[model samples]
Target: MIGLGELVNSEGEFGVDDYRACLAAKHANLERAIQEEWERPAPDQISLTALKRRRLKVKDEIVRLRTGKAIGRRLAAPA
Candidate 1:
């Protein structure tokens, strides 16, 4: 199964940056929704919980992509 962040271009590297941007936008939207829910006179706990969970999952995906896409490692032989 191809994951959203795992899709690469024909050149062997796709727009990780672009994907990150999209995720960032979604995260922002989710955050706004959460805030709006919180500010309501009677917030729905169930709805709030679901929104928070989705936000958290999105955040985690962002972090995962960040670590995988933004890191550089030097492979060396141990002496």
Candidate 2:
């Protein structure tokens, strides 16, 4: 499992926008994997669930980085 620390550098080597873009790409790849798994004749529920969870985490991080909010903090409900 890839952690935020792995994608980010503590030495200030990379910027926040770069991390956001990486997370976005990772999220998109996870979505594609989920879709492909769904299309399989024998879909693996365990793998699909794991992928979805990771995707959610990446998405949460992306939102936090973009809006300067805490990670995993729920967004306001849309009207």
Candidate 3:
């Protein structure tokens, strides 16, 4: 699976700066989900496009969190 950076970079509609900025904002939103316990999100409350965007945001967050954990492990190892 493509990572969040790759996915955001692949967006043709946005320039690199805007894409990165948007992804950063989405990342923050996903982090908030972690704090909020995302289970109760109202599925029927949002438009289809918004729902799809949220799904992708969560997927990207998963990729980001896993990558961060791996990096942390590597950094923690004795050099």
lDDT of 3 by residue, 1-79 (tens): 2234443333233343344455566656655654455455653434444655775875675566556543423211112
Candidate 2 differs from the real structure by a C-alpha RMSD in angstroms, to one decimal, of 8.7
TM-score of each: 0.68, 0.70, 0.33
If both were scored by lDDT, which would come out higher, candidate 2 or candidate 3?
2
Model 1 alpha-carbon miss at residue 29, Å? 0.3
Tell me which of candidates 1 and 3 scores higher on TM-score.
Answer: 1
**Which regions in candidate 3 have their CA more than 4 angstroms from the true location?**
1-12, 38-79
Candidate 3 whole-model C-alpha lDDT, 0 to 1: 0.49
The lDDT per prediction is 0.73, 0.75, 0.49
Please provide, for model 1 over 1-79, each residue's C-alpha lDDT reduced to its tens digit, 9 standing for 90 to 100: 2344454554445465656666788888889999999999999999999999998998998898878855453322223
| Backbone-clash count (model 3) | 0
Local error of candidate 2 at 59, Å? 0.4
TM-score, candidate number 2? 0.70
| Inter-residue clash pairs, candidate 2 | none
Clashing pairs in 3: none
